[model samples]
Target: MIKIEDITFVAAEAYKRSGLVLSTDKGYLLESRLAPLARAEGYPSIEALIAAARRESNDRLLWAITEALATHETFFFRDNTPFDLFKQEILPVLSRARGNMSTIRIWCAACSSGQEPYSLAMILEEEKARLGGLRFEIVATDMAPRVLEKAKAGVYSQFEVQRGLAIQRLVTHFDQSGDQWRIKPNLRSMVTFQKQNLLENFSGMGTFDVIFCRNVLIYFDADTKKRILQRLAAQTASDGYLIMGAAETVVGLSQDFAPVEGRRGLYGRSGAAKSAAA
Candidate 1:
C-alpha cells in the first residue's frame, strides 16, 4: 500500500494539470488502477510507481496516470431519452433555422469510445430525406487519446451494439464480421474525433449549435463545474441547445442559460440583453 501523504503532492500536481479532482476517499480507486501499471513496469508497489514517476520530469508516467484516471466507459446511445428529444424537436428546429447553410454542426464534448456521435450519425441518416440538401458534421472529443483511436476505428462487439442501438438501425448502418459490428464508411465520415480538454479555453474550436456534454461534470466540484459550464456557454450559439445528462443541471451553476420546461435535460441560452425599449 502507498502512503497517502507520499503520493498526495504528485496527485495534487496531476489534478492541477488535468483539472480532475482527487481526494483521500478515492485513494483505493487510484491503488487499483496503479497496481496493473506497477506490475507491468516491474515496480514492487504503488509507492514504487510514485517514486519512479517523481524521479525525472519526463511526462510518460504522468500521461499514464492521467489516462488511468480518465473516464472512458461510454457506449452508443448510452441513454435513449435525450436522443429521442433530439430527433423529435432539436433537429427539426436547427434544419429550419440553418436555411441555406447546408451543414449542421454538433459537438459531443466527452465522446468516449465513439458511441454517442455515431448514434447521432444514425439519427441524421434516418432523416436524410427531410434534410435533402443539407450536410452534417459531428465533432467528437475527449481528453484520452487511446479511446479516441478506438472511436476512430468504429468497431463494436455484439454486447456493445445491443446496449442501446435498435435492430433496424444496426442492419442499415453496420456490417457484421463474426461477433462485432463495424459502422459503415458513410456513417463514419460524418464524425470527426479529436483530443480536447474541456477545462481549458475552447475559443479556437468555434461555436456550435448543439453541445452534448453528458455525464462528464460529476467528476468536478461545484466551482470547476461552474467554470466549465461558463466556457461551454461562451462557445454555444445564441439559439443553440445544451443537453446534459439526466442527473446534471445548470441551475445554481449558471444564470446565462434557462431550462427548457417539459424537457428533462435541455437548456437554451437566455437571449442577450433583450433590446431596451427602443
Candidate 2:
C-alpha cells in the first residue's frame, strides 16, 4: 500500500526532475499512474515502487515516473480562435515587417504529439501565396522524449484526428495506414522535432519570429514562470509575437512581452512594452 507520505515524496521528486506541480485535487493520481509503472518494474505495489525510486539513482525509472506525471493532452489546431487570429492579424503584420528578411522561424514550445506545429504548417501552406517569397520552418520541441518520438513519427489514431481537424484537412493531408492516420511527408517535413527542457538553457536554439508557448506556463510556479518569460524575451526577436493559452497571461508575470492590443491570448515584444499591464 502506498501511503500518503510516499505520494507526497513522489510529487516532490517529479517537480525536482521536471518542474510539474501535481494538483492537490487528484487523490488517486499516484495509484492510477504509478501502479502500472511499479508492476512493470517487478515491484509488488506503489509502496515498493516509490521506495526504490527514493533510494537509487535510476535514470530510466526516474524518467518513467516523470513521463507518467507529465500531461500529453493536446489536439490539432486547438482552440480555433488563435489560428484565425494568427492568419487574419499576426501573419499580415509579420509578413510586411519582415519583407526584407525572407526567412522566418517559429518555435512551438512544448508541442505535444505534433498537432500544434502541423497545424501551423497547414496554415503556412494555405497562406503561401500571401506570404510570397518567405521561407518558414517550425521548430517543435517538448521535454518528454516519448511524446517527441510520437511527434516525430507523425502518426495519429482515429480519435485524435477527429478533434479540431476538419474533414477537408484530414483527407487532404493524411494517408490512412491500417487503423491509424499518418501525416503526409510534405506536411511532416515542415517541422523538426527536438527534445527540450524549457527550464534549462536554450543554447543553440536561436531566436524566433513567433513562439507558441501555449498551455505550458500555467503549470509552473511563479519564479520558474518569471525565469522562463525572461529567457523567452531574450530569445524572441524585437518585433516578434508570442501566443499563450486562453487562460494564461503575462500581465504581472514579466514586463518583457506585453499583451497585444485587441488580441486576447497573444503577446508581442514590439517596441517599448507599451501594452504591459500593471
Candidate 3:
C-alpha cells in the first residue's frame, strides 16, 4: 500500500532535486504518475518506491521519480496564433534583415517528442522558395534523452499525428511506417535534436534569429524563470525574437525582454527594441 503522506513528501523532494518547482496542490497528480512507475519497476508497492527514493545508490530510480512529474501536453503547431504570427510577421522581417546572407537559424528549447520542431520544418519548407536563397536550420533541444532520441528518429503514432496536424500535411510530409508515421527524410534533415537542461550554461550555443521556449517557464520558480530569461537574452541576436506560451509572460521576471508592439506572446530584447526605436 502507498502511504499518501510519505509518497507526497518524496515526490516533492525529487522534483526539487530535479530543479523543478513542484506544485503543492498536486497530491493526486503525483499518486497517479507514481503508481504506474511503481508497478512497472517491480516495486512491491508505491511505499517501496518511496523508500528507494531515499537511497542514494539508486540514481536511476531517483531520476525516474523526478522525471515523472514533468508530464505536459504537446502537439504539432500547438497554439495556432503564435505560429501564424511567426509566418506572417516575424519571418519576413528577419529575412529582409539578413539581406545578402540568406540564412535563418532558429532554436526550439524544451521541444518534446519532435512534434514542435517538425512543425517548424514544415513551415520553413513552405517559406523556402519565397525567401530566395535563404536556408532554414532548426536546432531543437530537450532535457530528456529518451524523448530526444525519439524526436531524432522523426517517427510519430497515429494519435500524435492526428492532433494539430492536418490531413494535407500528413499526406505530403509523412510516409507510413507500420501503424506509425515517419517524417520524410528531407524534412527530418532540417532539424537537429539534442538533450539540453535549461538550468545549465548555453554560452557555446551561437546567437539565433529566433528562440522558441514556449510553455516551459511555468514549471520553474520566479528566480529560475528570471535566470533562464537572462540566459536566453544572452544567446538571442539583438534583433531576434523570443516566443513563449500564451499563458506565460516576461513581466517582472526579466527586464531585458519586452513584448513586441501589436503582437502577443512575442518578445524582443529591450536593447534591440530600443535600437529599432532609435
Candidate 4:
C-alpha cells in the first residue's frame, strides 16, 4: 500500500500546478487512475511512480499523469437543454446583432473530446440559410493535449455517438468507419481546437460573442473559480453570453455577470439585455 500522506502531498502539488483540486478522499481515485501507468512504467507502487515523476527528465510522464487525472468525459450535446436554448434563442439574436459582421465567434472553454463544439457546429450548419452568409468560428479549447488530439480527429465510437446525438443528425453528419463515426469535414471545419489552460491569462484568444464553459469549474476552489470566471468575463464581448453548467452559479462570485431566469445554464454580462427579455 502507498503512504496516503505522501500521495496526498504530491496530489495537492500537482492539482495546484494544474489548477485542479482533489480532496483527500480523491487520493484513492488518483491511485486507481495512475495504477496502469505505474504498471506500464514498471513502478511497483504509487510512491515509486510519484518519486519517478518528481525526478523524470522527460516531462511527458507528468503530463500523462495530469491528463489521466483530468476529466475528459464528454459527449455530443451532453446536456440537451443548453444547446436547444442556443439554437432557438441565442444564435438568432446574436446573428441579428452582428448585422453585417462577416464572422461570429464562439468559444467552448473546457471542450472535452470536442463534442460540445462539434454539436454547435452541427447546429450552425443546419441553420446556415437563416444565418444570411455570416461565417461562424468556434474555438474549442482544453488543457489536455491528448484529448485535443482526439477532438481534432473528429472521430467517435458508436457508444459515444449515441450519447446525446440524435440518429438523424448522426446519419446525416457522420460517416460510418468500422466501429467509429467520423464527423463530416464541413462540420469539423467550423471549429478550431487549441490547447489552453483556463487558469492562466486568455487575453491572446481575443473576444468571443459567447463562451460555453459548462461543468468544468466544479473542480476548482472558490478563489480559483473567481479568477477563472474573471478571465472568462474579460474574454467575452460586453453583450456576450457566458453559459455555465446547470449545477454551477456565479451569483456571489462576480458582479460582472447576471443570471438568465427560466433559461438554465445561461448567464450574460450584467449590462447586456437579457436574451429572454429581448
Specify the highest-lDDT model's number.
Answer: 2
| Shift of residue 111 alpha carbon in model 4, Å | 0.9
**Per-residue lDDT value at 95 in model 3:** 74
Q: State candidate 3's TM-score.
A: 0.92
Candidate 3 wrong stretches, greater than 4 Å: 1-13, 274-278
Give the Å error, residue 41, model 4. 3.6
How many residue pairs clash in all the candidates, one count each?
Answer: 0, 0, 0, 0
Give lDDT per model, in order: 0.83, 0.85, 0.82, 0.85
Clashing pairs in 2: none
Alpha carbon lDDT of residue 103, candidate 2?
82
Clashing pairs in 1: none
lDDT of 3: 0.82
Top model number, TM-score: 4
lDDT by residue (154-182, candidate 4, tens digit) is: 99999999999889999999999999999
Model 4 Cα shift for residue 62 (angstroms): 2.3
Residue 182 C-alpha lDDT in model 3: 95
Considering summed lDDT, which 10 consecutive residues are worst modelled in model 4?
9-18
lDDT of 4 at 168: 97
lDDT of 2 by residue, 19-47 (tens): 88876555488788878878888998878
Q: Using Cα atoms with residue i matched to residue i, what is each candidate's TM-score against the true structure?
A: 0.91, 0.93, 0.92, 0.94
Q: What is candidate 1's local distance difference test score?
A: 0.83
lDDT (tens digit, per residue) of candidate 3 on 1-278:
44567656765666555457755566676678888989989987777887876765477877677766675468999998778877887877887788745778899998988888899889888777787877777999887776788899988999999999999999899999789999999999999887788877787888898999999998888888988999999999888899999899999999989988767789998867522221
